[model samples]
Target chain A: EPLGLGRPATPEEVAVWDIDIRPDGLGLPEGSGDVATGDGIYTEKCSACHGVFGEGAGRWPVLAGGQGSLTDARPVKTVGSYWPYLSTVFDYVHRAMPFGDAQSLTDDEVYAITAYLLYLNDEVDDDFVLSSENFAEARLPNEDGFKPDDRMEVEFPAFSEEPCMTDCKPEVEITMRAAVLDVTPEETAAKEAAEKAEAETPEPAAEEAASEATTEEAPATEEAPATEEAAAPEEAPAEAPVEVAEAPAADPAMIKAGSKVFRKCKSCHQIGAKAKNRVGPVLNGIVDGPAGAVDGFRYSKAMEAAAEEGLVWSHDELSAFLADPKGYMKGTKMSFRGVRKEEDIEALIAYLRDASE
Target chain B: QDDPAIAIKPWMQELGDGVDVSPYGMPSPYEEDVKRRTVEWLTADPVSSINFTPIHALDGTITPNGICFERHHSGVAKVDPAEHRLMINGLVDRELVFTMEDLMRFPRENHVYFLECAANSGMEWRGSQLNGVQFTHGMIHNVQYTGIPLRLLLEEAGVQAEGKWLLAEGADAAGMSRSIPMEKALDDCLVAFKMNGEALRPEQGYPVRLVVPGWEGNMWVKWLRRLEVGDQPWHHREETSKYTDLLDDGTARRFTWEMDAKSVVTSPSPQAPITHGPGPTVLTGLAWSGRGTIPRVDVTIDGGITWHEARMSGPSTPKALHRFYYDFEWDGSPLLVQSRAHDSTGYVQPTKDQLREMRGLNSIYHNNGIQTWAVDADGKAENVEIS
Candidate 1:
C-alpha cells in the first residue's frame, strides 16, 4: 500500500486461475461424473498413450494396480499404489491433462475420468459415480503412507559431528562401472555436425535434436524436472521449451519462406522440438527420410507396403506424392488435395528438409 | 629455441572477425562441446524433458545464463514481461494482481543461490548409469538473481492469520503448482525476474519465477503467475505423488523441501579426463547445502581411505555453490577420487553405501551421496561406484 503498487484483483480474475484442489476437498467444483462416462473419455483422449487398462503404453504413467508393490526392488508408483490423495488426481487432470491438449476437459469430464481411474485401480466399482457431495467418502490406498520430512531430526545429528579426514576407511573396491553397464549411448556423428553448424550461426530457436529429444522411450516423473509427471498425469511443457542454444544453420530468407509452405501441413503434422505423433506422423525428416520411419507412429497400410518395398522418400518420390496423394498411392491416409503449384511444392520440400534437421 | 607452431599460427597471417559480426554473441566455435545436452531416454518427449548442464567443462560458481540446465513440464512459456502479471489471492485481505511495471515500482534486492533439481544425480542411484559427470551432476545451477522478496508481495495483499500455506502456480500449459509453508514463503523467498544481471532465459522463466532459497528447485516454480494463500497444504500431485521420497518400507516423506548437503568432483571425471598424463593435476568440484553455506570440501585420491581438506575458492554465499580445488602430483597410476562436503550446519556428506543403508535404493530424489571417479593407468576416467 505504501508503494501504491498492484491494483485490487476482481473476483472474476481470481476465479480464472485459482483452480488448485486441497486434500480436504476444499476446491471441488459442483459436478458429477460416472465411471462409465469416464471410461469413454479416457479411451478417446488418454488410452492412446496411457493404455486401455492404465498399464501405461510405452513410458506413460500407469494409472492403476500397483498396490503393495512400493517395497519391491523396482517399485511401480501408480495412482492406486503411490498417490496419497484423491484431490491430486482431480486437480492435476483439471489443470493439465490429455497431453498436448490441456485444460480442454469440462469439470464433469475430469470428475468422470477421476472416477474411472478409481475404478481401474479397483478402489471403486464400475457403476460408481463421483460427485462433490460424496467425494470425501472415496479414500486412496496410500492415504496414510506419507509423513513429514524427518531428516533434520534423524539424519542431521549423525552427519553433523566432525568427520575423520585420515584412515576413514580400510579399503576401496569398484562396485559398479558405467562402462560395464554401457547404458549411456555414445554421441553420434550427426550431433557433432549439428553442433558445428549451430556454432557458426544462431537459428531461430528451432530445436533439431529429435533423436535425443523425442525418439527414445523413457519412464518419467522421478520427482524433479524429469521429476514430477506422477499420477497427476500430463506435464506437457507449453510447447517445446526454446532449446535456444542449439539450432542448425540455414538461410533466414529460405526458412521464412519455408514456414509459409508449412502452414498447410501444420494441422495434422507436427515438427521441431514439440513434435509428437498425433493425427499424422511427425514429418520432421520427411523430405528425404524413409517412408514410415517415425518410431511409435502407426502408418497406413499403403505406406507400410511402400516401406516394405524399400521406398525411401527421395526428392522425386516426395514431389510425386505431394503433387497427387491419391494418384501416387491408393489408400494413402493424407486427405490434402495436394499442392498444385510446382514452386510451392519445391519450397515445401526444402522446408521439410531443413525443419527436420 | 622458439616453437615453430607459434610462429606459423594462422592468427599471424589472417585477420579475425570484426565486432560487426554476431549481433548477439555466443561462445567461441572451439567451445561448441561446452553446452547443455540431454539424455534422450530420460523422458518420453523433449517438451516435458530435462537437459543436463556441462558442469564438467565449467569453472567458478556462477552458471552462464545460456547453459543452465532446463526442466520443463510444458516446455517453455515464452511470456512477454510487459504483458505478464503476478496475482496474489486466496485468504488475503484484498486479492491483487501486479503487472511487471507495478512490481518494478517496489524495492528489489540481488542475491546469489543455487537451484538443484531433487532428481539431480538420480540415475546414479541404481549404479553408475551415465559415464559423464554432466549426466550425473549437471541437474543443478548456481546464479545471481535480482527481485523483490515474496514477503513484500504477500504483505501488499495483506495475508490473513489462518493463511498457513501458499500455492505457487506457473503459467506454463502444465500449469505447474507447488505448495509452500508460510514460514518459508515469508522468509528469504524472492519473486525473481533477472538472473545473472539479465532478464531470465525463456526456458528459465523469463518474466518472473519464485525463488525458494535452500529449497528443492521444483518448489521454485518457474513462469510463476499466481500465489494463493490457504490454510493448509494442498497435497498437490507434485508434492504427494512425485517429489515425495519413497522409502523401501512403503512409507514416503512428503515436504522434503530442503536439499541435503551434496558435492561432486568436476575435473578428472569421465568427461574431463587427465589429458596431461596424470602429473600435477588439479582436482576441482562444487559443493552446496540447502541448510546453509558449504564451508569445507574434502577430496580423496584413494577413495574414502584418506581425504585432504580442499581449498575453497570463489565467494562463499549461503545456499549457493562453493568451488573447491586440490592440487596434487599424480604418479600415473589407477586412482579412485571422491569429494565430501561439510556444510555450516556441520552436516558431512554421506557416501552412497551409507545413504543406501538409511534410505534404500528406491529413493530417487535427494541422493546427495558421494560420487566416485576411477581414473585408469591411461589417465582415462570412468564413473564407478566404490565399495
Candidate 2:
C-alpha cells in the first residue's frame, strides 16, 4: 500500500471534508425540488454567468446542448453534455454554484436543480425523480467516455523489455527516403550531370538578352498586369551604363553578425532552404525582390494591395518595414513590437540583403 | 535581519525585473540552490516528466513557500486567488457556504508535518543509479503549517448521521477534486492557511488548502474551493484511476494515503562527492514518518556488514524533518555506505532487495528503500546498489 497511517484529523480538516455529498445520497434531506424549480433558479442565479440554455455566457463553461458534441470544433458543452454522472451535478451544484455564493442551497433546492439539469441535458424526462432512492440510476451520457487506460498493461511490459544488445539487426539498410529534397538517387545523379554540363556552357547570350529586355521595360505598373506600352520608352535608361557596380559583396563577418541579429526576427519570420511561412512571410532571396512573391502562402490583404500599387521590395522600403512592421503594413497580423536597437536593425538588413542573392 | 522591521519591497519590485506574474511564484534568488532537480534530456516531453525539490539544499522544519516541490498529472492551475470560493453542500443537514474569508472565522492551529508525494522515491526502486542526493531524496518536504481544524467547520454546519465522506474540490480551471473519508476528516486534518510564519505562498495553496499531514500531497488540494459531505466516497479520478497503485496480481491498493517511513543521506552522496580525503566525513540527510517522529537513524559501512547509530540533530518533531549525521574517519579504502531510519513506531527502513522483492521493480514512484553510496579509494562517491 502507499505509505502513511490514517492520522487523526483536525477540526478544520474535518470541516472541509464535512462538505462531501454521497453516492447513496444519504445526506439528502427533506424538501421537494424539480426541473421547474431549477429553471427559475438558473435564470436568476446562473444565466448571467452561464448563458441562457446553458450554452455558456462567455468564458464560463456552456452547461447544455454539448450532447454528442465533445469532438466538435466548438463543443457545446454544459453540465448536460459533458458531465459523466448525475452525482457530480448534485455534488457540484450543492458545493459550488451561483459562482461565489456556494453552499447556500437547501438540499431540496440542490435536488430540484439537479433534476432540472437532467431535464436540460435531455437525459431525464421532466417527470423523473432525483431523490436519494432514484439518484443512483442516473448515469451520465458520457459515462462510458472515460475508462482507465489499458496503456499500463501494454506499456509496462515494453518498458521492462530488454533493450537491444550486441549485434542487433546487423543487416538493416536505409530504406526511408527524404521527403523534402524532391530527388531520387538516379534522378539526383542525372540532374547533377546536366547542371555541370550547363554550367560549363556559359549563358552570357541569354543573360544579355534578359538585360536588354529589362532595359526596354518599365517597372510593373499599379494595374495587376502592366500594359505593353508601359514598357516601351525605358530602354535608353537601362542601356545608359552599368555604373556603380553592385555593392561590394558583404563581409563574411558582417553576414555572420547579421545572422545573429536575424534571431530577433525569427519568432515571426523564417528563412533559408525549406523555410515555411510562420506568423510572417519567409525571406528567401527577398532583397531587391518582387513584393508578395512567395507562392501559395497567404499575405495580408494590405501586402497584396501593396503589390498592386507597384511596391517592389527596394532597399529603402525594406529598411522602413524593418524599422516598423505594423506602421509600414497596416492590418498585418504580426504582433512583434518593433526592434529598438539600431545596430541590430542595420546588421539584420545587411544580412538579409547579402543572403537574398 | 533580527529587526523584524526589514524594509518591505513593493510586491512588483520584489520579483524579477520587469515583474512577470508567473501564475505561480518561484523560489527567491537566495534559494537558487533549492529547485526541482531535473534530469536533462532524459525524456522527450517536459510537460509530462518532471522532478522534485532539492531537499538537501533546504533548512528548517518547514519547506519555504516557494521551494516546496510540485507534481502535476495535467498541469498547474493558473487560478486567481481573489476569485476563489469554497462551497459545502450535499449530505450535510444544512448546506453550508463559506468563502475563503468565512473559513478564517473558525479556529486555526499550527502544525509541523511532512507532505510527501507517493512517487517520492519511485525512480530508485530498481537501484541506486542516480549520483545526486538531491535526485534520490528530494521529492518530499517537511513544514510548519497554520490552518483551521476541519472538524470545527463541519460541526458548524453539522454533518448528518449518514454523512460518511467529504469531497474536496479546487477552484482551478481543472476543477481538481478528491474524496476523503469522514473518519479521516474528523481526525487530524487541517484546512491550512499559512506555512512557516507568513501567508501561504500561491504555489503552496496561497489562500487555503486541505493539509492532511503525512498523507500523499495530491489529496491536499490547493486553491481549495468546495466541500460536499456525503454518505460514501466519490471514487474520483485521482482516487480511482491514478493515485491507486496496481499490484502485480491486478488488484489495486486504493486510497493509500499515509506516506510510510522513509529516509535518505543528503550530503556526501553522489552529488556531494567527497571533497575531503581520509579525514572526518559528515553524512547528513532527513528522515520522517506519517505515523510519528523518527526516533533513530543507523548508518552502515561496508554494505550493511555492521551498523552504527548516528547522532540526531535539529528538531525531532513529529511528521517534520529529523536531520541525522554520521561522522567517521575514512582510511581512503573503498566503502559501501548507507543510512536507515527507525520511526517512533519502531518501523525501520528496509533494504533495496527487500523493497524490490515486495513491490517489484515495475513502479515509477514510492520506493523508500535504504540508499547506498559507493565511496571509491580516490575519496569520490558514486551511487551504487548493493546486491
> Which candidate leads in TM-score?
1
Q: Give the Å shift of residue A208 in candidate 2.
A: 57
Worst window of 10 by summed lDDT in candidate 2 chain A? A218-227
Fraction of true interface contacts that also occur in model 2: 0.01
Error of 2 at B18 (Å): 21
Cα lDDT of model 2 by residue, B32-125, tens digit: 6556656432222333344567766655455766667765433455666566666667666546556666666676888888888776665455
The TM-score of predicted model 1 comes to 0.79
* Candidate with the greatest DockQ versus the true structure: 1
**For all the predictions, what are the DockQ values?**
0.36, 0.02
> What CA root-mean-square deviation does each model show from the true structure?
14.4, 21.1
User: Best-fitting candidate, measured by lDDT?
Assistant: 1
Tens-digit per-residue lDDT, A81-197, candidate 2: 545556667766766665556677778888888887776666665455677667767787665444443422433343233222233333322121111111111234676897688
Q: Alpha-carbon error at B111 in model 1, in Å?
A: 0.5
For candidate 1, write residues B93-196 as lDDT tens digits.
98999999998888999999999999998887767778898999999999999999999999988899999999999999989999999999999999999999
Model 2 accuracy (lDDT, Cα): 0.63
Regions of model 1 farther than 4 Å from truth: A190-357, B1-4
